[model samples]
Every structure is written in C-alpha cells, then in structure tokens.
Target: MTTTHDEDAHLASLGYTSDFKRDMSFWGNFSLGFTYLSPVVGVYSLFAFAVATGGPASIWAVVIAALGQLLVALVFGEVVSQYPVSGGIYPWTRRLWGRRWAWMAGWIYMIALLVTIASVSYGAGPFVAMLIGIEPSTAVTVACAVGLIVLVTFLNLGGTNLLAKLAFFGFAAELVGALAVGGWLLLTQRHHGLSAIFDTAGTEGNGSYLPAFLTAALLGVYLYYGFEACGDVAEEVKDPRRQIPRSMRMTIYIGGFASFFITLALLLAVPDFGKVVSGEDADPVTTILQNAFGPVGFRVVLAIVLISFFSCALSLQAAASRLIYSYARDRMMPGWHALSRFSPRRAVPPNALLLAAVVPAVIVLGSIVSENALTKIVSFAALGIYLGFMMVVLAALRARIKGWRPSGPFTLGTWGLPVTLVALTYQVLAAANMSWPRTPDAPWYDNWIVLLSAGIVITIGLVYMLVARPHERHDAPHGDAVASTLDPDSGRATEPARVG
Candidate 1:
C-alpha cells in the first residue's frame, strides 16, 4: 500500500480502472489550481462590478469570501483524499449520498463550468484588446472570447501534457505579472491610505451596507472558486490523494491572498473613484494598469493577463471534459457509449472534448445578444456553481449527522462537524445573496434573470433524474459488498456507508 501504484488499487476499490496517463507532477497539479484560480482574470473582470455596486468599502469582501470558501475547500480537500476520482464533486457526492445526488451535482457543476468558460473568456476581451492597442469594442471583445474558446478546444485535443505545460507557464506569468505590476503601483503611486477602502462613496442609495456588501461580495464568491480544478483531474495527477488535498488548500491560501492584494492595491491606486464607478473606466484594471505601466508596460501586463485568460479557459475546458468523460464512463450522460470513447493510445476523450467546446461556444453567444453580457453571465455562473457546491456540503453534513466519520487522509477530525455546519451556512447565504434581485426599476427580464436562469438549469436536471433514475452502473455494488473504510494509516473511504 506504500507504493507508487497504491493510487491505482485505491481507485479500483471504488469501482474503476485507470484510463488516464498519470503525467501531472505535484507542480502540475498545483499549477492546475493556480491557473484555474487565476488572480489576474478574476480581478480584471469583476473588480468593476464590485466598485459600481459597493464602492471602496467592498474591497473587504474578498477576505470574507475567502474565509467561507476556505471552509468549503477544507471540506473538499478531506473528501478528495478519500475519493480521489475524476469528476471530483460528482463522484464524491455519489460516495457520500447516492447516485441521484451525484447526478444532479454533476449536472449543476458541468453547466456552471460551461457558462464559466464563456464568462471568463468574455472578461478576457478587454485585456487582449489593450495588448493589441484596440478600443475593446463589443464586437472585438466577443470575437476575442470566441476565438480563445476555439483555441483552447484545439489545445485540449493535444492531451494532458500540453495542459500541464501551459498551466505552469500561466502560473508563472500571473504571479510575476501581478506582483511586478501591483508592486510597482503601490510604490510609485501617491497615498490613498487605508481609510480609502472603507469609504462608501457611490453606495449612497444602494440600501444598507449589508445588501450592498453582499452584492459586492459576489466578486469574492465568484473569484475564489476553481480551486477544485486539481481534484477534477485527480486521475491524471500523480499521488492524487495526497497531492490533490494539498493542492486544493494551497490554491485557496495563495491564490486568495494574491487576488485580495492585487484588488486592494488597484483600488487604493485609483486616481478618480467617480470615474471608476460610473464611466468608461468602470473596469478600472484597464485604466489602472495603463496608468501605472504606461502604454508599453500596460501591454506587458496585458500579455501576462492574456496568458492567464488562456490558461483559465484551458484548465476550465479540461476539467469540464473530464467530467463528461466521467459521466459517460458511468453510462449516465446521453450517448454515453460514444462520449465514453477514449483513445487508450492518446489518452484523451475526443467526443467529450468536442461536446465541451460546442456547448461553451453556443453559451458565449450570450455576449452577442446582451450589452451587459459579462455581468449577467458571471452572475449566472456564480449562482449555478454555488448551488452545485452547497449540494456536496449538505451531503457531507448529512452523512456526518447520520454518524458517518472521516475516512480521508485530510480529515478535520474533531472539528469536522462544526466546520461542515458553518460552511453549509455560508454557502446558503452566499447563494441567496447572488440570486436576489437588486434593480428596483429594471425590466422584469433583467431583475429576475438570476433566479429564472438558475431555475431553468435545476428543472432540466431534476427532469432528467426523474426520467432516467440512472444508477451508477448496471451491476452497482450493494450493502457490505460496497462498504466504506478508513485505514488508520491511509484514511481512504471507498464507498458510501449505509446508515440505519
């Protein structure tokens, strides 16, 4: 059990054989998390959204969001240690609750990731325009986003090796890029002082600080995710049970801190708060970076930002494809036979990859129809992903309440139940905050967009679950034959424990 092949035996215990080539190193696994949690991409896209909604006072939302997501990530790390499977959330939920719960979780998570790809790419447009010295017109931005989606689709077809390389490159580029540019801004700029972030300038009529804060916190709730990227590709990462849990934690710790720093620095460096909240400079990253770096330095930063955007899409698509492959392999998704087709030689799921590309490409068309497309797309994604997340959290809490104990190497041990309760509470509050309508006089479609869209996604999943009533496999293990265990030394749980 103390060998390199130990992971294979552990995976087989849960009823699957390895189909992926284990080529990702600990760095590669870590890089996957970092790239997926790309700081540059998150702050660049949503910083404006936060400022407009909550002003400088909203800067603290990152810390609050990180604290909550850290709780979520800790639970995820513990689960992943025991159930180190591809399609991380889906399989983990299946092992914790049942096949039905797993199917719905996968459904929600898959759709979230798909919309995330579109949103992140849509966000990338302005940065790319800056690098190439263009105005970042709506058409140019949409085209850029669509083009990158196609590029990542082709790149994914090359297999995991290229993704690993690209992930590492992205990790380096973003870190150096953020620190170099962020560091320069803080050093060269005049003082806005610590009190500036506490200033609620434009939040005059936006209700109490609580509501405005919640809306602004979407930046954090939205930004702090994608750390689970490592677990989704667990089959490909070496020593997954150990490496993945560690990667998940570090992804949140380092990535969260970096994003907060870059955000705070940019906010403090703002020359005119009024221009940022209500004018063309709303996104601020464009103006702030250009102001700090000049046109030449701005392009350099934009280049790094572009690299991050590319890797984020690449990692996101890679994660989504694996989820499809995982579902297909279990005979759950439509056309499972064809989607399950994997080239043992190339170690890739071409059909799943194709589906992943086509869906996002179609989803990105939202950018074409809506003027405020990126915000709506992001809000939609945040809602979907948070719902998907809370399901797993609820499952874990239920299992614990029913007397289930930790069997994972990364168990929270004595603190497990308490942490689970708090985490579930945070997720519920966060999800509600994102779904609430903020506009008082807006059109019906705009006001209820988040709720309507989220409902549609959930309805589709529930209908499928009811119609199919799909089980994990034809000969799914039953009772004692498929029991859970935790080796005192290894702490790996193979199957869901039945509760009386």
Candidate 2:
C-alpha cells in the first residue's frame, strides 16, 4: 500500500521516520482544516463585535484578512509540499531555520494554540447555557467549558480515524447550517440594501470609521487560520506532499468565502443595528436566529453552532498535540520521551493529548476571576500565531535569498519571493495593529494587555533558547541518518535517506 511504501519514502527524504500511521485521505485532511477554521464558531462569536465596531462596511475587513492569509497559506503550501512532516509550524520552522529558531516558533505557536482552546470553549459556553435555558454565570460557564474540554480530549485519545469522521461531520453540519440559515435570512429579512455595508451606522461617538473598522476587523483576524492543521497531520495523510498542500489551499479558499457570505447575510439581516451595537442586545446572533426562524429554528441553528464549536476544539487540540509530539520526538523539547510517546494501541500521543487538555482547562478556570481574561488572552493568542507565522515566512525568505529551491510537488515559481514579501509585510503590520494600544480611557494594563502578554511569552522562549539550548538539528530523531544536505549555503545539515 502507498500508505506504508510511498509515505515512508517521502518521510525519509525529509529526515523523518515512519512513526504515525498514514490513514488519512484527502477529504479527511481537508475536514481537519475546515472544522478547525470553524466558520460558525468564529462568525457567531464575533458577528456582534463586528457590527458594533464598523457596522456593515467592516465586512470588507474579513475579505482583506482572508486574502492576506491566503498569501501566508501559499507560502505554507510550498513548504509542506517540500517537507511533509508531522508538526506544522514548529518542525517546518526547524528545517527552514535551525533548532533555536524553531524552538521560539514552537513556543509562540504552542502557547497561542492552548489559549485558542480556552477561547473557543469560553465562547461556546454561553450557547450551551442558552440551549439549557439557564443563566450563564461565570461558574456555570466554567463548568460547561471544563466538561467540553474533557469530552473532546477523550474522543481525541480514541484514534485518528474517529477524529477525522467527527471533523467531516462537523464540516457538513457547519456548511449546511450556514447556507440554510444565512440564505433564508438574506431572502426573507432585508432591512438593509446592498450599499448598507458602508453606511457606518453603528460606529457612534467614535471620531472616525478607520479606527472602528480596524477594531471590527479583529472579528476576522483568527477566523481564517486553522488551515495549518492540515500540515500538522501531514504524516497521517496519504501522499501528503500532494494532499497536504492542496488541503491547506482549500482550507483557506473555502473557509474564507464561507466566512464572508455568512457575515454578509448576518450583517444585512440585523433589524435594529443601533440597539445591538449599543450592547442593549447582548446576544445578537440568538436574537437574529429567533426572529428569523422562531423557537424550533433557533434550537436547530444552535445545534449546528454547538457542533462547530466542538469540532473546532477537537481539531485545535489534535493540531496542538501533533506539534508537541513532533517537537519532542526530535528531542527538541523538554520531556522528549514522554510527550513524544504515542499510544501503542490507540495510535495517538497520550501525554501530548493530556497536556493539551490540562493547560486549556487551567486557562478556562482563570476566567472566573477576571472578566477581561478571556478577551485579553484571545487577543494575544492571535498575535502569538502571527508571530510564529512571520518567523516561518522570514526563514523561507532568507532561505530563498540564499538560492534554496523547492524539492517537493508544489512551488511558487517566479512569484515565490513577491508573494512571501507581501505575506511577511502583512503579518508585521497585522501584529503591530494587534499589539497597539487602542484605548486611551481604559487602565494602562488593560490597554497594553496584548503587548504585555506577548512580551512575557517571547521573553520566556528567548530565555530558554539562550540558556537551555535544546537539541541541535543533527540531534533530531533521525538527524544522524541523513544522506545529503539539500543546500550548501542553507545552514541545514545532511538530508536523510528516503525509507521504503
């Protein structure tokens, strides 16, 4: 079977061994990215925020963000095609740069991913409370969130195939749900016209729409990600050199458009924009659903949202664990043997899965003390991912300037450098925008929250890299077994033989 022969051959070419089983198909790989992107979970959580910030015109920001991310995805697709390894960003960065660079990338990415789990769980808690018809207090929400994490962690421990199935189902649920609900709302409820998006109706008291639109665009910031999950599962997907890259591109193409239309439909459907933007309507999504479809419809739509949140958590955790296992397996991280060990029977990393669960659970618990914890944590989370992504882009750009070429199935050809430049520039601008002090009225810590939080993480990672000095490139699991170095000037060591 190609699963054993073809996959392992490619792995050996990239210096990775045959470890995880390659049972994932093209659709299965796509499903992970789709579910992780989780349009419903993302759009619902931020729809009101977008409306409040920039009204309909801010919807353009989603499109802009998606296009920007597509550039990043293109770079990623090229890299993953050349080296279809397990860990997405961490391992990819390690190969492109070095052990030191990779560790910082891993540190930034892993912490952000863990915070993402908590953010998704916290966002979904209110929906769970709404479904149960109970007031969602801090304690109630925390309990529901803890239960959600525990349940998903168990499902993740079961095996890869089951996780893939659930991801596909989640994709189906979200797609059908978005089209059905969004389509109906568009056709029936038309309080605003096609030009309404630029009306700037909700950005009251704010001096200019530019600042408000920028703030509103945060809704679109993290939504387009989760495509990298495909790259993370490269080792488990058959013919990953081909499939993984395609899966990543498709993840962005579909997730971006779906997010755009659903947002458009919701924005166009708002009956009273002023009230919702003013925080008078605390739950605008639920309000829109109830008014459009009545009680039964609201519940049905809520079910789809729940499934989306569940799937997003599932895929995010799966990606995070794979990152841990890949880094640790190379002895590049602490507790290498333990975190890297896969379940003999289950075919998953038991320790990594557990770490994924525990860290997020602790973050969720802290939400009980401070109301702004989730907001600040989620805000910083996007910046963290951006930081890691920029590093990867920078490394690739550096390698290319040194005459490195793609050895895998995909390449940007003449457009490689230009696309990478745009991507890198976009990430730096976006990261700065995210980290800037937005509010002059809020407390100093609150205003500088994202920057401070990011500083702490960056400092920790840099300190570890300087002092601890993790395993070098040659110390990777099969590092010594390399047969040739890909490029002489690329600072990379010998490339390993392809096992078949």
Candidate 3:
C-alpha cells in the first residue's frame, strides 16, 4: 500500500527521481517478466538440442535449474526490495559496492541484453517465415528478424502503457496456448507413460551422463533469466519495494511451471523417442505437432509461437533500454547526455530505445557472415547474462560481509547471508559450466566463443574505465554511502551505517 509519493520519496532517497509514468501494476510487472522469460520461446528453441544432448532425463535440468535460480531470485528480491531502482543489477551493485563496480556490472549486462535482443529476434525469424508460409531461407529469416525488432521498437516507443498491455496479452496468449497444447497432447497424443522422463535414451557418454546433463541444463538457465526484467523497470511499478520482489518470484514460479509442463508434454508426445535420441528425428517438435494437429493446426500453433517470440524480444528491448538510460542518467557512460533524455510526453527514453533496436539489428546482420553466427551469439548472450547476475550477487555478498544489511520491506532478514552465498555459488558453477569448451571437433574459437566474447567485452570495459573514468563523474551521486542511512520502513534517511 505504498503511495505514489512514498515511491517517489524512496527513489529520491536513493538519489533518483521518478522519470517514468509508473503505470505498471503488480500484474503488469509480472506479465512483463513472464513474457521476457517466454517459456514457449525457450522451450521451442532449445527442445531439440536438449533432447539430443541428454535424452528424456534432460527434463530434470529444468527442475534443478529452477531450484538454483529461485535462490538467486530470492537474493535479488532482497536487493531490489531495498534498492527499488530502475536499472536493476547496475543500481543494486552500486548501492551494495561502489561506482566502479556498478559501472562494470552495467557494462557487461547491457551488452548481454543487447545480444539477447538480437538472439530472440533472430530466433523469431524462422517462426515468422513459417507462419507466413514463406521459405525460411537465410535472407527471409534475417528480414523477418529485423522486421520484428523494428515492430517492437515502435511498440516500445508508444509508451509504458502500450508495453505493459502487449506484455499482458502475450502472457495470456502464451499461457493459454501452452496449456491447451500441452493438455491436448497429454490426453490424446501421449506416446509415452509417466516414467518416460526418467529414461536417458542412450545419451550417456562412456556410461556417465553428467556432461550431457550439464549441457542440457542450458535450457533452464536461459528460461529462468527473463524474470529479472521485472526489476529492470522498477521505477514504473507502483510500490516497487514490495511488488517487484513478489512479481519476480511469481515470474519464476509460474514461468518455470509453464516451461516444465510444456517440456514434459512434448517429451511424452514425441511419436518416436528413439528416433529423436538417435538423431533420426531432427525436429521432433514440428514432427509431433504436425502429427497431432496437422498442417493447418500446426500453423495456428506457429502463429502463437511467433507472438511469444515478438513479446520476448519486446521485453528484452525494454529491459536493455532501461539499463542504458539508467547508466546515462548517472553519467556512467559516454553519450550520457543524449541517452539520458527522457520524453515527458511519452515518459520513455526514446534514444535509449533506439540504441537497443539498432545494436540488435546490426547483430542480426552478422548472420550473413556465418551460418553458425546466431548460435554463437546466443551462447554468448546466455553466458553474459549469467555473468551479470553473478556480479550483482557477488556485490551483495561483499556488502553483507562488510556489515551492510538489506533495509527493505521484503528482506530475507537473518537468512540474507546464507541465501546470497548459495546464490553466488550456484551462479559461479552455472557460468563455468556454460563457458567450458565442449565442442572439440569444432574450431577452437567456436568452442571458446562464450569465454572469448566475455573476455573481449570485459577487456574493452576495463580499458574504458581506466581511460574515461566515467565512474568518477561528479554530476550525479556515485556510491552507496547515502544508501546506508535509508530507513527500511519509511524510505527515509537516518544515521549512516559504516559500510559501503
């Protein structure tokens, strides 16, 4: 029941003012995160790969990843609950650590988000072409992907209200489609029994399944992240300190269930599990859907899938632009003046939105260079996002060790340090698993693309930090000394704590 004035005062105490319309309700925030975490998109994109890599048992990765990410989400809930800032990881890190740490965290995260936007739109291209009855040629796919990016950019430019409405529509459509499709498959098309999920289907290498399972875990890693988008636009949500944390947790709970349900139904519905496991059925999703629903019905399902992709891309763009604007607003990057300009009429950062669209579109064009470019882009995007999450988690741990407690309405209280420690541990292991070079037959660079991409980005950020010193800018408040004094209940300042 925090009022608008209270929200504004909370933001002010954190050294920022309300520049957004604050039209997003708790449901709207949840919808935004749900669409960003787009179970349909993630399941459709990675289903074949996961099955191929780890067989039916790969589904367990979904559960395991959900459990791990829930820990991270709980840690994030405490952080965002206290900070309640628009930039999410960036501001949270700043308040927990220092300006330099926040700068790097934002830098890495912003790049990852841009790459993810490209990856999602690029993924949508095939679906769009399929829905339109066009050949999914490279040229056609690129055109479709770029067109989707442009379409979402315009939608985002329309304002937060439009964004929230489309996100909610997407959430509704995607959820209903998932349920209807999964239920129908379960009732009339299931080819396997309840125990099929436990079968490995001969995917184990040398009698050990751990490697394959870890590779397949990428599906869950990718799906769980979009929940953070709820907090990226924290300033737009009413009573964000309480509502955003709940929205984030709800996003993971609901989105995770939807993902698990769809994946389970798909596994049970496959007409030939051996065909899928042995690579005879390269596209089991299409094979199963076409067999169950026929061409016309499959096309209807494709249309729904296309909507899910569009909404996922839309949410990614929105989150990326907010991070960019947040960086600019704090003068923590070059071109801050131009990127920070907020349109009062639309209550949107038009320039930041444009940057989000343009970078991803350029990345879409990179597909012309190599057929595998999109896959590599996606790999790096996932890695980058996990790394970004780890940075925030690490900062929070450091702050807790230094005696900084979360002073928020939704704090973990005595459990804070334990949750933060576990979340950080999970993130580190997940990230290392993601970056491990598994493809030995492929070129060295191909196998190392994830780490290489991260290294290059980090190197550039480090060079820029040393040269430009954006964190030292004096126009805006830069660190967490002011934040230590914030009263958890009233969002007012008190005597400062002796921690960063």
Candidate 4:
C-alpha cells in the first residue's frame, strides 16, 4: 500500500507540497462523488420535465448516458492516475496540453460548478417547503434555496473529515431511500407495464421523435458528471493516483444504476402517463409518492430528498473550492494569494469556500428576475460542464498524438487513444445537442441560452487570456509532473525522478 510519505513524495515530484490534510480514504472519496452525483436529486428534479418532453422512452437516455460517460470516466481515470492533481479537469488539461488551455478549462468549469450549486440548492427548495407543509412559492423557494446554500457552506467549512462523514451518511440515506421507494412503488403502485417505457405518448413533435428524445436526454447528461468531484479533491485523498480512479469509476457505476432504477420506477408508477406527457401533471414524482406513501410517509421521503440535495450541494461546493484553490495556487487567477490560503486548523480553503457560497447565492437570487431562471441555469450548467470535460478530452487526444502516453497505474494501454477519441466525440455531440435551439416558441434568448451562455463565458476567458496572460505565471508548475517524463520509442516515461 502507498503510504502518506509516498503520496507526499509524489506531490514533490509534481512540483508541490501536500498542503491538505490527506486523511480521506477511498470510501470518503467515493462518498463525495456519489453524493455529488445524487440520483435522488437528479431523478426527482428532472423526471417531470423529461417525461413531459419525450414520454417514458426518455428513460433510455440514462442507459445511453451511462455508457458514454463510462468512456469519459475511463479516460479521466488514466489522466488522474498519472497527474492526480487537485483541480481535476484544469490540472489534467494543463499537463496534457498547456497552461493557456488549462486556464480556459478551469474558468469554464468553475462557472459551471457555481451555477450547478445554485441549480441543486434551488431544486432542494421545493422539497424543503413540502417537508414543512408550505406552498413552494417562488419567494419561499428562493429563500429556502439561499438558506440551503449558506447551510451547506458552513458544513463544507467544517473540514474534509466532517464533509466526508456527512457525504457517506448522505450516500447511504439516499441509496436506501431510493431503493425502498422504487421497490415499494414497483410492488404496490405501478400503473404501467414494462411496455410503457417504449410508448411515446404523443411526444413526437412534427412526426419526429428524435428532437424530443434529445431534449429529454438532458436528464442523464446532468446526472453523470459529478463523479469528477472525486478527482477535484485529489490532494485531500490518500494514495490518490490509484484510489481516485477507482472511486470515480465506482461513483459512475453506482450512481448510474441508482439513477436508472429510480427513473424507471417513477415512470412505471406514474398514475397517468398521458397526463404527465401532456404536462397536465407537472409534479408526477410528488403526486405518485404522496399517493403511495401517504402524507406522513411522503414527508419522510421529502426529508430524505432534502438530505440528498444538501449533500449534493455540499459536494459541489467542496469541488468548486478545491478548483479555485488549485487555480490560485498556480497563480492562474486574481487574488491568488488570498484564495490559495489554507487554514491549518480547519484544513480547508476558507476564502475559496466562501466564494463558492456567495456566487451561488447570488445566482439563487436571480430567481426573482424570471420564473424560468432556474431552468436556464440548469441547462447552461450542464452544457458548461460538458464543454469543460471536452477540453480535457481534446487535450488528452492532442497529447497522445504528440507521443504522450499515460504513465498511470490505471492506464488504458493500447486502448488509450481510442477511448479518448470516442469520449471527445460523444462530448461534442452531447454538448451540441444540449446547446441546440429547440424551443422555437419561446424567446430567442431562451432557446439559445445554453449556447449563448457558453459563448459569452468562453469569449470572456479568451479575451482575458490574451490581455492578462495569466498562464505565463511561474508561481507553480504548468506541465506534467517531472516524474511523468516521457521516452520516445516506448511511449512511456522512464523511471520517475525522485524529489528530495
């Protein structure tokens, strides 16, 4: 087993010291990723929209997404196994390509994570209100959302140990809750046969089912991503080069299975499939659970759902703060010194955590501007995340073409380039599908929100890179670890250089 001394020596070779506590075990890392990819939150939040837009057939999107994301996860495993850096996509891109590309990748990913924090907290609002027996009005929901953000921020500030404990608890509660609810619904409340999954229920817009299915596929796209959070906190985990990869794959497998199970159960148990497809039943999840579980039981489920949401937000905040700290540590952003400051007592970056909280709370307040703001936020968050992911995939492809072979313990070997290419291709198509203007009847900006938001953020990052050139700073290493020095003929690194 790799000891803490080995981990620290590895970091030294990578041109850094282990500033974090490094107390998180493999299970804690897995819990963090699992909570971030909370199936309860994903299915509960998107079920109504997906079912209404594409009928029950939309559940297939989960399977498709899981397979595609598994490819991406494989590629990430190879990267993180070698680099094992704290910022995940940012550092991986930096090592694979260069600093300029990494700056943009981190910039895009940071914004996406902040938006997702808002999205998850906003989603938790209704469940919070439902648990308290109050109407989920816009005002009440936004207030609750902001409150949850603040609460989760405090939880995150409590240090990695507490975060890991809560994350593990949240994972257990969410999984058990999902299984119990799904099984109960299947056994006692199912209204449709398995055939219902194939029925379109008239969601075929203009005699073509393709567009509707693509639109509904956002459900799966949104759920599969949080697995990267495991890599985002790499510096805090023990033996990360090996353990983080395993934890990431485990997160996708377990989280993907849980997502599919809950979605299928909900689809089969819908009291009126036609009503949901017609949008007449806007809250089918709540309706089904309330009818099946009764008021008390439904409230209990709501409490469980709220816990899932909280854990999701906690994990997101943790990931975001780590990325910020990583960027700051590399002097890739403004106020680097302050943001990079780590609390010796708490073993966390306080300033970065606070920034994560503030940005999301401000976004939550945007709910007052438009009732549909949260939907737009959610859409753009998914698109931005995929775009960031593709950046790393593209970088890996570039590196492979330039004679870079993964020196990690978890490499794909001869299959490396193939998996990277497929992952990149899938991400591109998925991102385009997400950003495509599908809502012809809505405002132009509404239809174009995903693409437009991405364009603006990328444009800003490009302009900043050109003018500021933050990537040129020498505050930290900007390429692969010295230990990963490559050899030409074998396409593998020579013996790693030991750092004294």
**The 10-residue segment with the lowest total lDDT in model 2:** 477-486
Candidate 4 lDDT tens digits, 452-485: 8888889999998899898987556665533256
What RMSD value applies to candidate 2? 3.2
Task: Flag clash pairs in model 2.
Answer: 57-197, 482-496, 484-495
Q: Clash totals for all models, in order?
A: 0, 3, 0, 0
Q: Residue 102: error of model 2 in Å?
A: 0.2
Q: After best superposition, candidate 4 residue 132: deviation in angstroms?
A: 0.5
**Cα deviation in Å at residue 429, candidate 3?**
1.1
Per-residue accuracy of model 1 over 1-500 as CA lDDT, tens digit each? 13447778878877888789888887888888899989888887788888887888888888988899889988888788878888888888877887888888899898898888887887788777877877878889888988999999888888788888888888988888888877888898645988998987666574577777788888887788887889999888888777888888888888987898898888888887777667657557776777788878877777888899999999999999998888888877778899989988768898998888888777666667876765665557878888888988898887776556756567788798899999999999888887788887999878988987888888998898788766545453312111355444555544433211
For model 3, the local distance difference test gives 0.88
Model 4 TM-score relative to the real fold: 0.96
Q: What is the C-alpha lDDT of each candidate?
A: 0.81, 0.83, 0.88, 0.88
Residue ranges of candidate 2 with Cα displaced over 4 Å: 1-3, 202-208, 477-500
Per-residue lDDT tens digits of candidate 2, residues 1-500? 24558778777856778567777888989999999998888888888888887777878888988999899999998888877888889887777776777888898999999999988887788888888788989998899889999999999998888888888999988998899888999999768888887778858464767888888888878688888999998888888877888898898888888898898899888888888778898677778889998887788888889999999999999999999888888777777789988887888899999999999999999888886777777777889988989988998887776555655667787798999999999888878877888888999998899999999899987887777777563466321112133545665643323322
For residues 382-408, write the lDDT of model 3, one tens digit per residue: 888898899988988887766667778
Clash pairs, model 1 backbone: none
Candidate 3: TM-score?
0.95
Among all windows of 10 consecutive residues in model 4, the one with the lowest summed lDDT is 491-500
What global local distance difference test value does model 4 have? 0.88
